[model samples]
Target chain A: MSGTSMTTRAWLLLLPLLAVMVAVIGWPLADTVGLSFTDAKLVGTAGNFVGIDNYVKTISGSNFQRSLITTAEFAIISVFAEMVLGVLAALLLNQQFYGRTVLRGLMILPWALPTVVNATLWRLIYNPEYGALNAALTQIGLLDAYRSWLGEPGTALASLIVADCWKNFPLVALIALAALQAVPRDITAASLVDGAGPFSRFRFVILPYLAGPLMVALVLRTIEAFKVFDIIWVMTRGGPANSTRTLSILVYQEAFSFQRAGSGASLALIVTLLVAVLAAAYAALVRKTAGSNA
Target chain B: MSALEIENIRKTYGAIETLKGIDISLDSGEFLVLLGSSGCGKSTLLNIIAGLAEASGGDVRIGGRSVLGVHPKDRDIAMVFQSYALYPNLSVRRNIGFGLEMRGVPTAEREKAVLETAKLLQIENLLDRKPGQLSGGQRQRVAIGRALVRKPQVFLFDEPLSNLDAKLRMEMRTELKRLHQMLGTTIVYVTHDQIEAMTLATRIAVMRNGRIEQLGTPEEVYDHPATLYVAGFVGSPPMNVLDGVATGEGLRLDGSDRLIALPVHFKNAVPSGKRVKIGIRPEALRLVEDDDRQPALKVAVEVVELTGPELVVTGRVGGQRVTACLPPRTKLAVGTTQAFAFDDDALHLFDAETELAFGR
Candidate 1:
């Protein structure tokens, strides 16, 4: 067959997918863009176009600004913590030890649980009355008495981050473990014979193999942490003066709770743009690391 | 003092013993090749000596000091691996200098040593490139450079040239020999290639099933193999064995009514009607005319292979297959009968049951 016909046939095969994408994604996206420019209600007649008023108000509002800062803090702190904890876990599990296979299998349990279920479990653990975490801390002489965890603004966001990390760090560990397996035994042996201590061996010989894969995990976890919603919503409902509120949670409150659809659409688009920028930066970093590794 | 010594080293994995009891001592500046086929425990012995793997029993010493529980880095050894194992992330210079860097050598001194090592290996131009950017031969040079820079008390190579193409392997083999001459470093090399063992080793230890079959100089190994396995393994076309039974007057060939005279020294060494195996190297057998005075065997020729320098002819002798290397231009054809004679001094006799060489 000629090249032109092949191209035509490829397009024909892709037509159904493209159509579905236009209906589900493209149409909704277009509608949201239109809605952002008008004063619209969740269930009422179409509002008159106000031309950039929603965008202006959303960008200037305290809610958008505070949520953006909160989202950034959560994403940066949680992703950094997850990467370190994950790599440490992976390194430990990679060693020769008893019950290693069982431990590796059990490591996936938290990640395997549904986000809502994981959030609910953490809530019980953080309960101010008789939560396991409070009981354990008091028993260990670290706490004077049981204190409000999820109910208080000071500890609410930190508690959510800990819970989020528990549910997500295993994914990073799994990726790192696979990369560790690909490191040739001979190279490590050579390094050992070259008079390298354990730390040097890991830094000079093993880290290069892990960098590319870990970068992938970093990008994924960072983006997920930035747009986090379900876990916080289920655990705290962005509670205690909105201290644990993230961009997604703010968007939900603006659109559904307050029924301000126009400004909600504007705020969501701004968050999407920020995430796109972060993803692009991480993609560039991945490319550079992959190139150097190759 | 010996440069390296392995004293009755043993390794066991669960119930299977990988190294039964290996003992080898190397003097300074001697190249000892552990020559064996795969699964022969040659690599296990090397690892034990390098302190990469622990020996279940016995102790290893370097420079007369026991290194049994010492870490590999503190053992004062350097190794070249089969895969080259050059750090793929670092430039060639850093790969060669990494050991010194780990030891906290000054930056300028490490760079100078790296440059000198790279120049000796003729990889000066590749110092700026990663291992991924080099050809197989170049990668091999970098691996050697990594080992050479340290100038350790002992050097171990685990089939370092096996990854190269045939031509490159030959080149690297020559290069290795040249390096050994220049540095005069104590070395232990491992390979299954007999040609490599013969050409490079001052002493070759032939191994089988986690035990040393024979250990001797290359000439001693080639000319006077101590065991049946060594005789079969150390030759290219390989040594051929014919079954015979000793008689009072001579030896009777199996499946044939021919009596061949044994060497005078072996005549009374065996009892009458005792079975023995006679090993003859292919090059030791020569085609002879019928009227030749030398005692000869009638061989039923099966195949003729003309390898550039010689004609290797495979044939049957008294129900046993034998290979003989003849003159390149000799006239020979398949399915023909020929008379072949071997020098009496070239004969090797082994008891059929024990497969151990008989006393001359």
Candidate 2:
């Protein structure tokens, strides 16, 4: 075939997907970028372009700086904790035992629950007066009085971290479990004949096999955590003097509650940029790992 | 004590019994092959010996010790899988040395062993590359190197060469025999190919439905098969069998008047009018003269196939298609009728109901 005809054939095959991308993501993203530089509210027909003002204001605000820190802290801590717990769970579940199928089915239930519902359930459990956590702590003689978990400044972020881990660690567990399943049974057998104990077998055989999926899960969970808004928004609403505030929560507050369209639009753009950077970093890491292995 | 001994081992999965009862003994430096078709429990028996799968009801002893409760790691055995299960993330050096590292071998010793094994397998140039960067033969060599570094008492192979192409398979077959000769270790290998079984094994165990049908040397099984199944399965083009009835002087074809004289032993044991299956190899058939010296049959040549070394000619004798092997340069063509005969001593007779060969 001629090069021109080959190029046309490739475009012909890609036409449908290209049309869908333009309609769904390309046009909306372009509209958002245009609106960010203008003074248009959600209801406005038109507005004058005011260049670089929103960018300057977005970078200079204390609220934006604090939320950026909060988002970073949330992303780092939650993803780390989830990775640890997920790997442990996957290891335990990978072993053959009685009732293994039932246990696997139960593990998937937490991941299958709605995120909003999980947040609501955790909120009730963290209530100060008669919640399950407070009741158990007092009953166990660890506390003399009931303490509000999501209300205290020192406890609010910690409480939200616990809730976020509960809601999302199963995703990591599922991914890790898939990776564990891919490890060849013969390699593990060979390790055993080499006089490796269970711990050594995991270190040498299982962990090396799981490296690819672990990196993938780490990247995906970090990106999801950086933009997390639903569970934290419902549970604490960035309360207790904004200690639990994140970039996504700030965007919601500025655009919807406080109605600062320019600041909100500018904050949203910054959030997009931050996510893009992390995604790029993860993409580079994955590509490097793949290329080296190949 | 022998290196390994299995006594009346049986395996059952749910209600379906796969392996009936199998008994095998392996001496030190012996290469034993369990040869059978798919679903014949050859792999299952190998897994049992490796301690990967437990025998439902039997004892497996290795080096005079029972390995029933021993873990696969503690069994002092290494296996190369058919898939060449290499660790994708690790370099060839790491993969080959991983077992030594697990056993607490020092880094210096591990490196020396890895280098020696890689040299033995001729894979020294591939140490820094991952398995994905190597060819199928190289990957297979790495798998062998991984097993060699363990220096275990016994080596188990589960059809390791079935995944390779024909030429590579032949090369690997030669290398495996050479390795066995040099190492002088006990090996329990499983394969469905009779040619491999014949060439590589000191003794061959033919399995059927999880039971050992016959166990002997290659020549013994090929020349003196214990049952009709063994005779049919051990040769290419298979032994030709036809149903007939024992008469006064010989056995007569069921639907025809042709009678074939049998040797003394078959004539005495086989009762008259009893149904019997007659088997004769294609190569055992020969062209005979129109004389009264011995009994003869007339057959019409239907097709002549000129293979490289031999000619396989199909013909019709007494309304049944029979094939005969002739010299490749013989003058023969389709639709040319000829008379063929076989020595009475070369005939094989089996009891039809039991499919067991009637002994001479």
Candidate 3:
């Protein structure tokens, strides 16, 4: 009797959380899986079971393949670039300077802003007619003429990557800076007295502390960059013959624009699977590095 | 020439002076310990000597060559920090060989040197393990090994054994002293532990308020403290001090009561009405069998503590709380009044106004 009452009390305490979790996460996930199996159109009669037809159609399409490649290219290049820039910025900001505290507070403003706002801001900055980038380039004599940045297929993806890096790299810097601070002062001092030069001291003493956090930041940035939608939508909208069409944009266009909800849902599921595989690989790498270091 | 010489070293932060100008020099194989309480700037002096910290004004010379603007890595000095500061990512062998590697020593030669240093430290088997795997004492040994492999002109230890447990600390203390004997290297160490200073140093510089109060051998400092503060600070269950007024024949303990009397033995006449403090080490005051000399302090015992080997008594000695270490099994009831005789030769007299030692 007592055990039953105790379990009842435990269930009472956990009920609200369980109800919220199922409502927010469980239902949509189950619904998405169910929809992936059917030929459900955005606007039509009730659809029949398509079995694996939607999955096959989504996979065999060249557009989906190209989008996957683009997503991978964008994520790998941008996350790598961001990691380097972020670590450098973190190192600079960690130093004792006149306005260090204020500068640190201001460093995260880009990341703090809404993603759409950041994308819109960058879109204006990349505008061929009156963008600051083109004006600066022309004034500096780096460019003979103002070239269309996001409007041209050759430069669109790279420009989107740069814009995306600028807005999100602060997350890495913030994490890296916190890790850098935890590197013991005495260890750095010890390295100095051990005849290490500044670069060597940073490599041997400070880099170890940075590796774990950098990996964690990389994981977060990779996942975010994989499903990137808002920035490309605002800046280029996968335009200039879809040169910057990522997997996320491809899935959205298939479902909402083309009204093929079954294939779109299947494509989205495929994207999720790809991201899950990549995330698992990253997690495995982190664990392996941690184990080996220990 | 002296191996390490600090000429007028000083450090300040805005309005606060952390280290007053300090001058010290050590012979080629001397183990010089900078002994002090916290905030005395011993560690600051060591840091300046190592070139880790810039002095406001000073010239530090190693092997008679001035290292005023030299980098710490080029200073021909290695330091062991209190935290052990072992590179967490590296194996013990790598940690030890890092300095040699930095100097561009050949790989085989560096490995051999690391091995030899590890063997010397009796940590040869633990070479492949990282710092995280080692015990506190082992990590400390590895830290010392790192410094030893550098083959520097001098070694600086900034309270290196402070992070270890008491038993391990004592063991490491002995190990350090033995290593010093074997190496005969010039070392400048900083520690607040007087026992470490006493047992390891060829000479101890007792610091107070960013200045060396006295510089002497361990025996000289303990047997003959130079100032009131030094006398009080140097000992465990520190020296008991009794303030009194100097009279024609001796010093009177109380203003009117005259609970205890201390005779001024120095030929330099102390003015009759001057205030003086009579300092006597707790061990120097004897519990008498037959009272030939009048006892200096007659007091009620407050706290009685059994500190492993000996019984420690905390009691009032003329309105001032003082500590005494008595022989084991010497019954000291909590509220009983007992007379303790002061040794004349062991008595330390200091002028109250100046706090300078008048006589020992």
Worst lDDT run of 10 residues, candidate 1 chain A, spans A285-294
lDDT of 1 by residue, B1-360 (tens): 899888899999899999999899899999999999999999999999988899999989999999999999999999999999999889999999999999999999999999999999999998999999999999999999999999899999999999999999999999999999999999999999999999999999999999998889999999888888898999998998888988887777798787777888887678888898888898999888854467677899999999989999999987789899999999998999899988888888888888888877
Candidate 3: residue B144 Cα off by (Å): 0.5
What's every prediction's RMSD, in angstroms?
1.7, 2.9, 2.3
Worst 10 residues of 1 chain B by lDDT: B289-298
lDDT of 3 by residue, B1-360 (tens): 999988888899899898888889899999999999999999889888988889999889999999988999888999999999999989999999999999999999999999999999999999999899999999999999999998899999999999999999999999999999999999999999998999999999999888989999999999888898888888887888878777766667753354444544653546777888878787776565435366456656899898878888888855777677878778768987777776567777789989988852
Model 3 vs. true fold: TM: 0.95
Q: In candidate 2, which residue ranges exceed 4 Å CA deviation? A: A1-31, A38-50, A281-294, B290-298, B343-345
- Looking at candidate 2, what is the lDDT of residue A187? 73
Error of 3 at B120 (Å): 1.4
lDDT of each: 0.92, 0.86, 0.88
Candidate 3 lDDT, tens digit per residue, A136-181?
Answer: 9999999999989998999999999998889888888999999999
- TM per candidate comes to 0.97, 0.92, 0.95
lDDT of 2 by residue, A1-294 (tens): 999999999999999999999999999888778878877665554666888787888789898899989989999999999999999999889999999889988998877899999999998999987799999999999999999999998999888888888878888888899989988887776566666788877776799878888998899899999999999989889988999999999999987888767667878988999899889989998997787656
CAPRI class assigned to model 1: high
Top candidate by TM-score: 1
